[model samples]
Structures are given as structure tokens and as C-alpha cells.
Target chain A: MSDLEEYKTVIGLSFGNQNSSISFTKDGKTECLANEEGDRQIPAIFSYQGSEEYHGVQAYGQLVRNSHNTILNFRDMLGKSSEDVTDKKHKRSAKPISVNGQPGFSVTVVDPETGAETTSKKTVYEFTVRHLNRLFESARDFLGKKLDGCVIAVPSDFSEKQIEMLSKASKEAGVPAMQFVKESAAQILALMYSDSALVDKFVVVADFGATRSEVSVASIKSGIITILSNEQDLHLGGEQLTEVLVNFFAKEFEKKHKINPLTNRRAIAKLHAQCEITKRILSNNTTASAAIDSLVDGIDFHSNINRLRFELAGSSIFNKMSDLVVKAVKKAGLETVDINEVILAGGASHSPKLTSLMWSVFPEQTVIRSSASSATPLAVNPAELAAVGAGVQASLIAEFDADEIAGSLTPDVVNAPHLTKPIGINEGDNFVVVFDIETALPAQKSIECVAPAEGGAYIPIYEGERSIKVTTVEADADESDFSEEEEPEEIRERVVTPGTLLATVNIADVAPKAKVEVILHLDAEGKLTVTARPKDGKGSNVRGSN
Target chain B: MSAGKSIPLFPSKTAIEASFVPHAKVSKPVVRSVEPIGPYFLAHARRLKYGRTFSEDER
Candidate 1:
């Protein structure tokens, strides 16, 4: 291989549903990059006030008044149709519209001079592109140079289509050379690099963010981390806790001023912001009081909530989180005793109540021959851990490029593939497993099957744990982009099917009972390659066909 | 203080016992892996991306 040149500037980005963070590697140390305001984590929000676009923290502030124009929670809507929206908050916050006949959001824009209002339809993909553009722009401003590449960390549950869309958006956003990684896997990389002694351990990662909670069981053996099982709750998140407080404060304000804060979007947004602060304050203190002046219709609102009251109000959300942890451990085919340590990620994990809940659920000791009693949450900065880990990955990727770029820094982390679903071949209506769930990637498996004389062998390969209702739609070529008004791409929903079809392989003109070897290899980037060959046939070997 | 400090999300002392009862059955794990770049997902992204190409700016 020829010597590859190093980049002038690159960054690692943790893209979350609610907030995102950026980090970079300098002199072998991963440092979280702050925005212009010197805040490490920036709100994943955008606001448009008559063509004046604001992003990050500024957009979050504008959301208080321009609730209709500000866009948040676009991350959760990726690869999902309007019908797929189950959360009431998302449904209420984002006005669903048709984009080219597909599900999209409507942004209400007002004319600056005429005071006329108009609406524009945009898909989640377009929204993501806008966000990515702003993120790259921020990084460029911070570094005083354009970014050459980036490694963005994403949720483990993002679908293949979603990942592809993100990659496409990165290219459109001017960051063409980019890589995507699972957030938990990135966190594990950061952990491994920080603690060299970490090996042969079964770690459960509980990543509780603003709008979702993810629990994953990962085992590290021989310098590689394999995700045993992953479970997530879309409904259970810090937003639920914030909603509890939002409602609580709203009701209190209503009782005093005879005005329902929830009735007004601006008031709700302001209360939501205050609730977030109260949630953080209640984390450390026994009681936290929230006071917002001119919160709703020029009325000041004050509400005091003790930890006990706050916990009771948000108990359902916590219950859902605990439920997810149990399911994750069960799916991993392990008991609580098997867990070495629970690694926490995201800002919500810092809540004392939530951390205590984690300890109670996964105690160090339970049954006979218990290895550990109470497996405490790993001590790490939960907010920036994933971003920092992504920086480490970018460094590792850089090292693989050239020895000059490595410059005396060698990350002791081995990138592992944590399969969300089993990759298998469909044979006679029965799924035959090739790569089992949680098997570390850069792994391969071979299967031998007899070829039929008449029809040969038709093998359908799929990647998914359970049967999913998939609707494949092609972009309508007849539709023109220059149309005055766009409809959510005229998508005709077809027959619902099960499983994602990775590829199909056909073995033709083979004698009956002829041995055919089928090998499937999952690469480091989670891409699969299939090779098929017949034992007695020459020039019939299919190499890396998929 | 620690014993009672924990919220009674589940009524029992052993929180896992009651909390383990899943309120909503998860048909699929929402946490999806990022699209593994066919090149990098194979453990060769950097080798394939930078190993061969020298950008004009870098040179």
C-alpha cells in the first residue's frame, strides 16, 4: 500500500436525537471540542425565522418563541414514515406533511416584508443535511479551517437506510470523507483506550439520552468487544422526565395565573426548557425549585419539587428503563450476575435516581456463585464519552492509513462488529443462520448444501432478528424537482414483507447432490460478502459476490 | 438512607422482580448499527480510503 497523507483537520461527532457533541484527537489525547459558546454538547435543534437560520444553542433558545419554525427531534424521524410516529410529543412538535408523496415535516415560514405566511415540506433527510452542514460549519469556525473528514457516532438501532441517508447527507454537507460507528461501541473504545487493563469483561452499556434509552451487553475478549445483545426504549428517555416536570409546572402556573401554559406553544417550549434545568438540579439536591419570569402571558411561575415528588412523577419512565435493562440481559442469554459493570452514557445517566435504579436492578450478588454483588455504573463523563471514543476511532482509522499520521500514538482498541440481528440464508421457508447475533465482525462462516438438478439452488440472505413489515418503494422518475409544489415523493406502499434482503445468490446447472460451499463474511464496516463455489466445478467460483 | 433513597418505581424491595415485567413487548431493538461502510465495515476503511489515494491538498 502507498503512503497515505494525513488530514489537516478532522473531527469525531456524536449525533444524538436531542444533542450532539464534537471531539478531536491531539497528541494522542482525545479532547471534546466546544462550540463558540464554549459548551461541549450542542442541542440538536434548528430554527428558521424568515430565512435567518439559527442552529445549536441559539436555535434552542429561539424554540421558546418560534416553536412552529424550530425543528427538533429530526433524528428520531429518520427512515420513518408519518404512520410510524407513535410518540405524542413528536406528533405534536412536528407537523407531518407529504413530501413527494412520502412522510415529511412542514415548516411554516413568514415573509419578512409582506407579513405573509407560507409552508414548505421537507423530509427528515433534508433536515439532517441542514444539521450536518451547520455542524461542519461550526467545526470549521472552531478550527479556522475546513474539515477534511469526520467519524460520526450513531445509535445502534439505526436502520441500513438511515445509515445510508446519513452518509449521503454528509457528502452533501461537504464532509465527504466520513465514517459511522455505533455509540456504545465508540464508548467501549474510549473505555479500552483509557483503561489498558480492561479485557475479558462483560459490560452492559446503559445509554440514556434525551429522547431514547439504549441498553447493550458487550463482552470484551482478546482485545475485541462483542455486543451480546442490545435493547432500547423509544418512549423511555429524559424527555419523559422533562415532560413530567413540564406538565407539573404547567399545571402550577395554570392554577396561579388562570392560564394554561400547555395551551400556548411558546409557553410549553419555555416550560420545557425550565423543566430540563429542574431535572438536572434535582439530580444533586434533595429539592429543586423552578421560577420562570414572564413564562406565560407576563406571569411569573414558581414551583418547588422534592426528589421524592419528582421520582414519583417520573416513576413510569424509570420503570420502562428498568424493563428495558431486564429484556436486554435476557436477550443476551445472561443473568444479572454475568454483568461485570454497567457503563452509562448520555446526559440522563448522570441523574442520581437513575444511577441508583441501575444498581438496584443489577446488584453485585444474587444467586449462588455470584461473581459480583452490586455492579456499579462505570465512572466516566457520560455526555462526551461517545464523542471522545469516536475521536479515538478516527485516530485508529488515521493510523491504518499511514505510519506518518500515527506519530507515536497507537490506540489499543480493536474495532468489533456488534450484530443487531442474525445474518442468515432463507432455505425452504426456514432461516439458516450464518452469522449469529452478537458475533464480533471481521468474522466469517461457511455452509455446505446440495444443489438440485432441475432448479438448482436459490438462496435469499437476510439481516434482521425478527420478521419486520418492510415496504420497498422506488423513487418516481416521472416527478420533476422543478415542480412548483412538491408532494412527499409519490410512494405507492406495496406489499408488506419480512426481513431485510441483503442479497440473493443462485447456483445454476449443478448436478443433484453436488456439494456447494457458501461463505459469508461481515467486514469491519458491517458490510457482508458472500462467496459460493462448487466442489467439482471449475470456473464456477463466485468470489465476494455480495 | 440509601435503602429508602431509591424510588419505588416497583413496589417490591427487589426492584428487578417487578420491574422485569415488560410493559410493552419489544418486537425489535431500536438501536441500529451505523451503516457499516462496505470498505471500512470490512475492517479496511482506512486501508482502502487513504492507503491508495493522495489528495491534492495533502500532497
Candidate 2:
């Protein structure tokens, strides 16, 4: 491979209700491709096809026409326990949540022959990972070469655990190394790219998508974005907008054709789809038509939906997400004006009224759409920016992984994946001694703690402030950083006490194994007297008092 | 009290716990590692982190 070819390539990924994308960088240009459009966002859509199965856009369309075999909005509902959302059954005809194939999420699926049941069972992570791996493989194919590595973009709100699942899924997708990017951070990046001042700037991004509404304000500096406040409603988004419009049209049907819209499952689905489309239209246009097909009462309604009314039905929800945007700004202790920019992104951000509301709320700031064009991209595409950022992160991380193998001066520290508590500490978990409610922790001050051993045992220098988190500390004598103040006048006959640490074994073997012997060094002040033998070979650690 | 009444300035417990060992007449105050200065973790995070990520050449 050429030098440029040797530069590790990483594929950036982003996924949504019905689509997933991949982007790759080569020769200073990046390429994007949407792998799953006609395909089901999650192929687990037909996992339990008792007799036959329906899938892809066909299954999506079948949702409205054939109620017996269709599920929608099942993606976002994953990972949530049933107790968290019992009403999910009403929203999705078949809840697709599953637990070990227990139908955690259900979707009604009509048997191609029987047309009896339209539901299957599986955990959200399991099902979603399966589909995600499939989608990722398709994205991998876009390169037309063997896979290199994958960078997966996860929702900003994904829990640490979710990221773990993402890691596993990425591995299953045949990508060993994966990096994470917050969706909001990615949007903020695209928002920043549209303008460079994004570094050291504060901006609120209201990501209103088909199934989720997330509001986050981030501060960018030195190409790093600090997510300040993140609040989102996984259960809320464009779906609610569609629901309100569905109800409005249902009422109109009752008045114009004397037919209730909800009596027929097929009609409800078709109407929901129609309302969703019209809602998007009304986001910009003053009005749009909502078309519904009815059978039993021989009724059909094509009603004009005004932008004003659309906002009336779902403005609260939008404003709810907006309220959080305000909080995002507030969390940074900045007013709307303090926000240099506001990013209108996500599939739902296209709402001009929503954009207008965001603008009016922060009249001074530019209410720019993070992603603006259809083909050429008027702005950065917020939807896929996380993927791009993840790719960038992946590339950087790939370099780190390679460099790691090459060896660096980084202090050898213990870190285990899924080890919540690293022997003594946890992953990414650090406690600082700060004076304020939530401010930067000051430089760690050395403090003394005792284990209260039976006999007089010598004290070993402990590194972590939190008892659960211990770090390896270099001996002060070995470090050049410490300089001696004039030696304290030694007290005559002070005498070494029996409790003195005769020897310290610093390095130890893993649990369930023998511990490595520790070498000891002592100082007059009774500082930690510890050292370690080189594990590889015999370079006997020197032991004596300094 | 005699003119040369001997008095211990510090309790042996403090000295011993300070990592001092007993010596004959006029025991020298030998210092060990830095007590207060450290990259200290309470229980020891490094032992765990290093134990897994990097295998000892012995392995």
C-alpha cells in the first residue's frame, strides 16, 4: 500500500428510523452513502415470521395497509424496561422490545399465509445490534475493499451501558476499534464548521427527529466540545406532531363524513403517515393537505393543515424541547444572546416555525440550520455529522492504537472494559476536591488515611483520594520534581519505630493469581518505602534509605 | 529530675507508622518514599489497569 493508502481509513456511521449512512475520507475528500433506505431500518422486523415474513419499505407500507404484520417506531423504544413505558403497546401495534427473545418490543406481523400475528420477541439491543451490524456491513461494502475500522455515532444520551452495547455491536459488525461521538456534539461540530468561532462559543442545538427530541448546548474550544446540559425525551418528537394531526384529521373525518378515524387499524396507519408528511410541509408552508383512506363508513377526508394549527397541536412538545434548549443555555450561565449561534438540525429542524421560534427566543443569535441543502449541503449535515466526527475520532484513535503498540511515555495504568470499578477506581470516574457546587477541582492535596491494621503495620503511600480508586504513584526520590528544603534538624535519638515499613511490594499480580514482589526504598521522614521488581527480567530493584 | 533527664520527643508509634525502623543509640531519621506527594488512588487503580491491559513479559 502507498503511504496515503497506509493511512488507516475509518468509516463514519449514522442511523435513524429508516436510514443509515457511511462516510469515508480519502485523498482529502470524504464520500457518503446511504445503505438502508428501502430496507427496514432493522431487519429484525421479520424475526418471527411464523409462516412467512414481510420486510423493508414493503413492511413499512404494510404497516398501514395490513395492520396484522407491521411495526413502527420500535427503534427508540429499545433498552427501556416495560415498567418505564407500558403505554408503548398503543403507540406501536406490536411492541418490538424483547428480553432474551421474550418479545421485549412487539410488532404485529401477518403470516403471509395465515395473516394471524404480526409480532416477534427480542431485546432492543440484541435486535438493534443485529440490524446495525447488517447495516454496517453494507456500509463497509461501500469502500469496495476489506474493512479497516468503524466509527459509530451513538445518540448523545446513550448511557454508558448503551455505549458498551455499541462496542459489542461494532465488534460483531467486524470492527474491533470503535470511538464514540455525541449526536449533539456532532451537530455542534457541523454548526461550528459553518462558522469557526464555534470554538470557545456556546450554541444550543434542538435535534427533533422522528422518534426522539434532544436538546443540548455545547461549548467548543480547541476543537473540543464540552456538552454542558443534555436533556431529551426519547418518547417525544415528530411522532407526537403526527399524532396530533392524526387526531385533528380524525375529528374532521367525523364532521365531514360522519366516520370515526380510529375504528380501522389500516385507516389509522394511513392517516398517521399522511399527517406525518403534512406536518413536515406545514413546518415551512402555511398550509398542506392531509389525505386519509377509509372503508367501513365509506369516508375520505382531505383537510388543509395550516402552520398555525400544526404548531398549536405540537408546539408545546416542540417548545418543551425548546425549553430544554433554553436550559442548555442557562446551564452555561449564558442568555440566548450569549449563544453565538443556534443550530436547527435533525429531520424535524426543517420546521421554519420551529426555527423561527428558536430565533425569536434568541433574536440576536443566528438561527442557522446545521444542515441546509438537499444535494450539495448548504451547511454541514447535522444528521450525519456525528458519523463524520466519529470517523475523525476513529482515525485519531486508530493512530493512538498504533502508537500505543509502538509504546509511549504514558504511565502504565490499569483499565478494564466493563470493569465498573478499576480494582480501586471506575472507568472515566474521578473525584476531585473542589470548594464549589460544581467547579474545577483544585490540585490534589496529599492527605493521610489509615487502614487500621491489627499489629503496627507500616503505612504505604496511597494515590487516590477515593478509597475505591487507587493509582500507582512514583516514589518521590525517583522523581526529579521534588527538591529538598533545608533538611529539618534531626531530633537526637528519635529512633526508628517498629511500625516502620520494612519493605513495600508495589506491583502485585492480578486477583486469583500470585502477587509480584515489591521492592522498598526508605527515607528519614518515613515517606512511602516501596518499589517493584522488573517483571521481564532480573534488574534487582535497589533498596535502601535515602 | 536529674540534669540529664532523658525525654522522648515523639511516641515510638508515630515514628514506626512513619516507616521508621529502630536503630541503636541516636537512630538516624531515615526517610522512605514521599508520604504526602503522590499520584495516589485509594485502593489502587493502576494495579488493576496495568494488570489487564499490559501483560508482564513473564507471561
Candidate 3:
């Protein structure tokens, strides 16, 4: 700790898709670190105006006039491949593009000297690296010295590759000692510091952000918090609700003026900005009015929408969210009665409808807790909760004894499976386990499987519990299987299983391969990868990328 | 600790102010670079509270 004391200029950062924040501890108190704008939360926005690149709130002001040059919400696309996003429609103002075979965005900017517009393609990774570099530089300037490293809070569902990318970006920013802090765990730490009563409780935590929502059930006992289950909807969040509002207002404007504002990019961008403001205003007021001057072709658009109308328009999304909550609770294997409290933490948690829905869902829980300060009567602004909590976690790491901080801030798993799914190899009538449940993480095992005598070996690897679906092969069942009485084909009536056929190991050779060694490796983050090799070493074998 | 020629890292008053002044004016008085309560001192003081013997690798 004496050597650790020499490098104490690290900051805690919460890099969000729509907004970002930083905080640091000084004189035994954690405070939100302000950006160049002197604001606690900076808009996670950036743009290239002429030849100069701008970031944070400064870039947000360029959205209206230079919408094409501004990039926002790139964080949501991180760790995704170009093909995964090619078919989906983007709702953001920035134009999504395949940048050199990667999922990225194209920004068209005018050259400052020539006054000619040119388009540049940037991957989400590149933008993120630039943003982090700028953030680190600002922190260094503010501290008036070099920093040790910073701790970043990330979504629970963020993949290992995404974390890897973030660390890579931090290194590009010249901050090399960075570590990840789970966002939910950081929030739990903040609560523990403020309130001691939460120690012995089963709490459901919901972090509703701009582009997605993650729900988890956590058990806290003796000041240690453990995540029981985590679930998320990647496509649902406050942005969806804002889209609903934008579409509603656009339709209303179109109906009266015989012109659709959505067709115009600038009009849609301006309307989006207004819709966001109206959405926040509607949270407190029964009715909110939206007006955009020269919204489309010199036509002014104005509409007054009430809370009921807004909620009704977004009811389907709300229902989907309710279903997600139910799914999460079911996965956690806990009934509503067993939940001791509901903890909502995020910018979108301020919505009355969301809060009321949680209350209705968990009626047994008398008090709904949030990341509010228990010492002070006033609630901690929901947007700053993750940042504040991350700041505390960083403080613990920097100053407290490693033993005391490690167990509380980082999860202490006892016999936790590396994969969420139960993995087994096919054995004639049933599947046999290479690694059993409660195997603790980062486990590896090899199983010898034989190839069929004549042809290629088809060794099936299955995940999750096996169940047989024996539908009687009755005559003329195709149309009957598509009965209106049953669920729509898209939504399967029953979960088909032999568990999931995760992979089928096969030899690509013309002849049969014998005595194949199928190796499975499960990493620390509960993710699996596979490698297969034949004992004879004559044929190519199939493998699964992690 | 040998005597050597010294040069200011921040030569201008404006540069010094920009380096030390926080983006937002905190309710607490801002610490000046010349003061004992600079960023280095403040962070150093906080680190001492844990009261642990440190290893070189721990740094």
C-alpha cells in the first residue's frame, strides 16, 4: 500500500451511450468530476465541424445544423459485427455504415479551407478510443499531473471482447492501469456505504438506460452482494419511448399539413431533440407541448400531448418491459413475495409510469429503493448513481486494504459454472458431462469421442437440460402445426429441445476419422469455446469461436 | 536531490490557472498549485488512511 500511495490520481468513469460522467474521491468524500462545460453529466456526443473535432456537450449543440456530421449512440453498437447490424434500421441521427468491413458510422464534414464536403468512416472502436483519449487528457489537465489509471463501470451483459476493446482504448488514451467495475456491483457498493440495512435482503435491481435495460436479482448478506441472475433487453429502453413520441408527433404534424416531417433528416433530428425534452417534461407535468419552428420546408409544427396519450402510445413497449421483468424474476427462481425490495437506478427510472409499474409488479415490497443517499434526505440524481458508485469503488481500490476491498467490490463466486448453460456430450441414449454444474469458472476438459466407421464423425455438443419433444408423426400435420389456435409460428408454442445443439463436431475429410479429442474451454466470464483434434491427425475438425 | 537549473512546466499564468482550476467551481475552495493541498497532497493523504504496509509491486 505504500507503493500504491504514490499513484493516487485515478478517476472513476461511467461511460454511457447517451450520457457520461466521471467522479473522484478527495478528502474522504466522493464527488462528480465535471467536464469542460462545468456540468456533472456530459452528453455522450461528438462531431467533426469543418476540420475541428468537438466532443461532449459542445458537439451536442451541432446536432440541429450539422446532424450528418454528429455521431451519437455508437456505444450501443460496440462489440457487434457489421452483419449483425446491417439488416436493422438505425433510429439515431448519425448514418450507420459498414466501415472497412466493420460496424461503424459515416460522418460527412466540410473541409475548413476548401469548403468542400467529404465523408469519413469510423468504427465504434475508433470513436470510443478518441473519446476516451480526450477524457483522459481532461482528467490529467484537471488533476495537473499524470494519473495512475481509471476504473470504468460497464453493463452486466457487455461481452469480454467489449471490455477488451475498452481497455485497448484506455491504453490508446495513455491510461494503462484501467480495470472494469460491474455497473450493478458499483451501485450496490454505493448503497452499502449509505445504508447498512440493505445487508440482509434479496433485491431486484433495474438499470434502465438510454438504449437498453438490464435487470438482475442480487442477494446481500453480511455486507457482501452476489448477483443471482442477470437479464437484459438489448433493443428496449428510454430511446424506444422517445422514438414513440417522435413518431406520434411526426404523424400528428403530417396529418394537419399534408407533409411528413420524418422524410426530412433535419426535421426529424430537430423533432427528436424536442421529443426528448417533452418526454422529460411529461414526467412531471400532465401535459407537455412540443413546437419546432421551420420543422419542414418552412412549416412550423406544434402539438400538445398529455401523459395518458403518451403512455397509451408507448403501452406496447411498456408491456414488453413488464414481460422482461417477469422473465428475469422467473430466471432468478424467486417469486414476487420473496423479493425484499426493488432498486431502480438509471436516468429513465424517473418516469412515473416505470416506477408505478414496478410498484404494481412487486406489491409485497413496501418501499422501493433507489441509489439515493441515505445520509441526506434528498435523492441522488439517478443519472449520477453509477458514476458516484464507481467513484467509491475506485477509492476503495486506491486507498483501502486489498483484502477488504476485493471481496466487497468484486464478486466472490463459490462453485459457479463457467457457462450459464449445462454442457454435455452425446452418449447413445443420453448426454454425458465433460464438466458438471458448480464447476467454478475458467474450467477445461477433454472428452474422447469415436468417429463412425464409414463416414465423418458427427459428435454433437449440447447445452442446457435435455428434453425430448416427441410429436407423433401423424399424417397431414403441416397445416395443423400452423393452427391459428397455437401461437404465431415466429413465437414457438413449445421450446424444442435436445437442449440446444450448440455445435456438431465433424471431419471434412473424405474418409472417417477415429478417436477424436473434443476439447471445451469455458472462460472466467461464463463463455465457452471449443477445439477439436483427431488422434490420427489426418483430418480437419470443426471448432467454435468464443 | 542535486541542485539543477529549473524551468516551469507551465510558463504562463493562464496555463497554470487552466491546469489547476476545476471545470466547475466547487463549493469548497479550489486548491492552488503552490498550496500544500494540491491534487498530489490530497490524494496522498487519502491513501494513508488504509494504514497498510506497501510492497513495490502493489504500486
Candidate 4:
């Protein structure tokens, strides 16, 4: 066995709507390799010249050309309703999606065994896992050896339930265990690792990728980093930067080549990619040039963009993010003086315009613009920052070499089951006023309201999504869900009071989407008694003694 | 004691059966006389006589 294969290497996987990548780490140093042939990325591009499957770097290289059939950026569909995706990923969309069915983007996958066609409706979670699993095999092949545990990077907004599904997929991939790390957190760790000196102070790490531009404020205290707030997006990133470059090349072509290259998808795909790389290089450099297209018989097209002018062309893009940075700074409760450093971390964060903008924004602070740590450095090419963080998380997993690992952390890490205190507030349609806490009383008050449903009623006292908007308090008022049998000829007058709340029982919004029960009691002497129990009536309730 | 007591309005079981149960037997055909009833319906009636029976002793 090779020395590199002697020690089992952990793999870090990052799957996104726009891109996917994997990194292998050994002895703590990571090499972010291209996941081609479905190794952390898609190699199969379905088109006329048979099926062109470009693995890893090649797949990324063919992104714009095969974007018509290449499905990326369905990351948002991980645990969401289908209605949310049809509006976005509709080109290769073969079927109408809905939330009630399985979640995520619907994609076509031909069974290898039978060659039968099938549309696999994978939830965002499923798609991410499937991609990760496919990448693992490719990674294993690349390594020419058996695989080890994995560290999977999850979106910052992914809830625990989605994490649970990801963990299950990893288990099926024969990865003994997996760890969940946030993209921003991993990127932050990767940046800190690559650029050594930024550990002393609070820095603003900006990430710009194909889909979105996000800014986050974080502080590294004694090498232990803390992310203060969630990421902010201006909805502008390298994709727009590429689009800007494409438009520039298109407009310049009409001026110089006298032909529109946008008419052909393949030709446009090849050139748009060249433009995307040129735009990224212009972020930090003076100028970059690329061949545009061919005109009449012998003429070849070339375009050169100056850094200063290209920045001007995408000025609105930079301007859109200015407020977001200010907002993030405000939310972080840090002033420009308080910000000791600024580090660029994403693909577009390498843009010279953005770098100069960062320098201008924080003239008082030290700004470190390092290229090594940016996640998708150039052309969204090989970068291991997210993968490195995932590897670090994987190393922390207890089952590095265990033959039979016990109690996989993957399940608990992603979907830690929690029991919400069953919200047991008496929630029959009738207001069963056991004791009104609203009444300012030395002596407690008790009033009984009618049953919600007419009949010898059964009230469940439901436990989720309940918040009562108290328009005005009614001291002696009862207006609730009507039952046909509870009909009285005349409506009773209700006296309205200030601060009287109309309460509906509901559950706490958390993983498990739990139901809670709140049981309050009143002593004959008018002291309030309380008990908190589970929705299943299996636990003790909280009692208010005083 | 008053809540727990069971009523025994009729004096004897034989007299009650002769008066009420036999009358039900006699009026059974009379009640069905209004309908175009089938004999198979009588084969599987609500109160059966031939098989395993239930009594107060069983209760």
C-alpha cells in the first residue's frame, strides 16, 4: 500500500444547489480534489454526442454548457415543499412538484440493472445524500482503497430533521459515521487554518459563490472561533459576476465582432465559462483576457477586461451588498474600529473590486485578502475549505477505526430528538377558563367556557403553532368556534376589557415539532397551581408553588 | 342502598314468561304479517332457542 493509503484518510463532502465537491484529508493537511465521474460532482451531461460525463474539474468546466440538463442548486429543496422548487429549477423539470409528496427536486435516474427509466423524486436531503454516496464510490476508486468515515457540510439553515435524513444516507454508504458542520463554520475554520494571523481579532468573512453572496461576522478568541450571527445575502454573487462578464462580452461582440454569440447554447456555454473565470481574476488583478468567439471565416474573437472598468460594470452588484455588510456589522454589534480584520473567503470574495471595496470599507482595520482559503477559488474549481472543516468534524467522531461503532453521533448530531413540553393549555372550542392568569388577583379567578364541538365533547388540547393575538381583553367575553347544536336564539353580550387574551393551544417549533401541555391549578384559597406534562400524559408537570 | 337496588315488579318468572314472552312469540307472526317477509329471516332471529343459552346464572 502507498504511504498515503497506509493511514485511512477521512473525506469531507459539500453538496450545493450550484456546486458539489469533496476533499480528502490526512495528517490534518487537506487536498481539495475534483469530484469528477460523480465524485462530489456530476460527470454525466446528457446531450447529442452520446452522454458527456465530466467528473470533478471537467464537470465544473462544462457547467455553463450543460447547465440546461445539469441539475445543481436544488439544495433549498432539501426539506421544503415542491411548490418552492418548480418556480426555480424548471428547465429539466419533467414533472410538477408538490410538498405533500416526497420533498426536493425531481430528477431522472435510469436504473443500471434493468435500463428502465424512472423519475426519482428525492427530497433535498435525499439528493444531497445520493450525490454524497455517488461521490464516495468515485472517491474510493480514486483512492484505490477502502473508505473511512465522512464529514458532511450542511447549509446553515438546515433544520435537525433534514440532518437526520443526511445521517441515514451516510450510514447506507457504508460510512460508519458522519458529522454535521455548517458551510460558514467550515469555511471560517478553513480560512483561519490557511491564513495564520487572523486569529487575534474579529473579522468579517465574505463568501460569494454561484448562487448567493453572503457576509458573516465572526471572532476568533484564542483559536476558538465564534460566529456571532447568521449569514446575510445580497442575492448577488459570482453567477451575476459571470452574467455581467457575459453581457460585457456580448455587448462588446456587437461592437467588435459584429455577431451575437448568444444564439448557440454550446458556443455560449464555452464562452460564458471563460467570462466567469476572467471576471473572477479581475476581482484582484489589473486585467485578464480570453478568446471570445470566431466571426466570418478566419477571424477569431478576443476580449480583455480591465479590473477598474469591470468593477464599474458590476458596480450595482457591489452596491447591493454594502447595506448587507452594514446590517451584519450592526447585528454583530461591532463598529469599523472594533473590527480588527477582514478576510475574503468565497469565490467572488477574490474579486479585486470586492477586495478594494473591503479595503475602503475598513480602512481602520487590517484586511487579509488570501487566495488559498477561498472555498471555490477560481472557475469554482478545487478548494478544500468546506471539506477541511468537514474532515475536522469527522476526525472528532469517535468511530475512526472501530469495527462496530456504537451509538452513531450522525443521528444525534443532525436530528437530536427532543420532546417539547406538551402545550396543555385547555384548548377546547369552548373556553374552559380553569383559572385566568390575566386577572390581577390576590384571589385567583376560575371560569368555565363551553365545549368547542357540540356533543358530549372530547377536547384533545392540541400543541403546535399557537400564539394568541390579544386585540382587546374581554373580562366576561366568550366567542369561540361555533357548533350547530350549541345554538341559542340570542347572542350573549360580551364585555371587553383591556389586555384580555384569547389563547389557542399549540406546540413549540423545534425538531420533533413537539406538542406541549400546560396544566394550571387554582386552590380554593385562590393561589395558582401549575403542572407541565408531556403531550402523552407521561411526565410530571411544573407546579407553581408561590 | 336505594341506588343499588334492582326492581322486581313482576311476582313470578313462570307467570311473567307466560304473560310477556309467549305473547312476544304469538305477536311475532302478527308483526311480520304487515311485510312480505321471508322464512330465512326467521331462521336467524335475534332471540334463538336451540343452542348455547345465556341466563342470570351465567351473568
**DockQ values, each candidate:** 0.02, 0.04, 0.01, 0.01
Off by over 4 Å in 1: A1-8, A81-87, A110-118, A251-261, A294-299, A365-380, A399-546, B1-59
- lDDT by residue (A1-546, candidate 3, tens digit) is 698557677777888887887778787667677766687777777888888788988888778888767888877667777776642335545767887767788877778889998887889888888888777777776768787767788888778888888878778878753457677766665555667532345677788888788887765432335576788887788888888999999999888999999998888889988998999998878999999999998998888999999989998887777667767877876666556777677777666677667667764343567433232222566677777777776766665443543333232322222233446666334456454322334445556665555635555556645233435434344776656553332211212133655555545442443666666665545455666666687677556643
Kindly report which residue stretches of model 2 are placed more than 4 angstroms away from their true locations once superposed. Answer: A1-5, A16-19, A27-31, A36-56, A71-90, A96-103, A106-120, A193-199, A370-378, A402-546, B1-59
| Positional deviation of residue A134's Cα in model 1 after best superposition, in angstroms | 1.3
Docking level of model 3: incorrect
Runs with alpha carbons beyond 4 Å of true place in candidate 4 = A1-9, A34-55, A60-67, A86-127, A142-144, A191-200, A255-270, A281-285, A294-300, A372-383, A398-546, B1-59
Scanning candidate 1 chain A in windows of ten residues, the lowest lDDT window is A365-374
Which lDDT tens digits does candidate 4 get at residues A197-225? 22345667666665676677765432334
> Across residues A1-546, which tens digit of lDDT does each residue of candidate 2 receive?
778667665676665654455666655344455454633122234333445445445455555555544544444445555455454434545644435533355544467666676444645565566666665666666566666677666676667766776667667767654455666665554334335431234567777776777787754322334455767777676677778888888887777677786877767877877877897787557889876555336565667978888778777777776776777677654556546666666666666666666655764434445443232233445555555545544544454464442232123221111101101111122221111111111101112111222322222322222222224444455443464653332211111112221222222212122222333222212232333333333323323232
TM-score of each: 0.63, 0.60, 0.64, 0.55
Candidate 4, residue A248: Cα displacement in angstroms equals 1.3
lDDT tens readout by residue for model 1, A229-276: 899887678888888999888887778778888987777877888888
Candidate numbers, best lDDT first, in rank order? 1, 3, 2, 4
Q: What RMSD does model 3 have?
A: 22.9
User: Of the candidates shown, which would achieve the greatest DockQ relative to the real structure?
Assistant: 2
Docking class of 4: incorrect
Instruction: Name the regions of candidate 3 deviating beyond 4 angstroms.
Output: A1-7, A86-89, A109-118, A370-378, A399-546, B1-59
Quote the chain B TM-score of every prediction. Answer: 0.17, 0.17, 0.25, 0.18
The TM-score leader among the candidates is 3
Report the error of model 4 at residue A459, Å. 65
lDDT of 1 by residue, B1-59 (tens): 00111110111122121011111211232232322321123232233344432122124
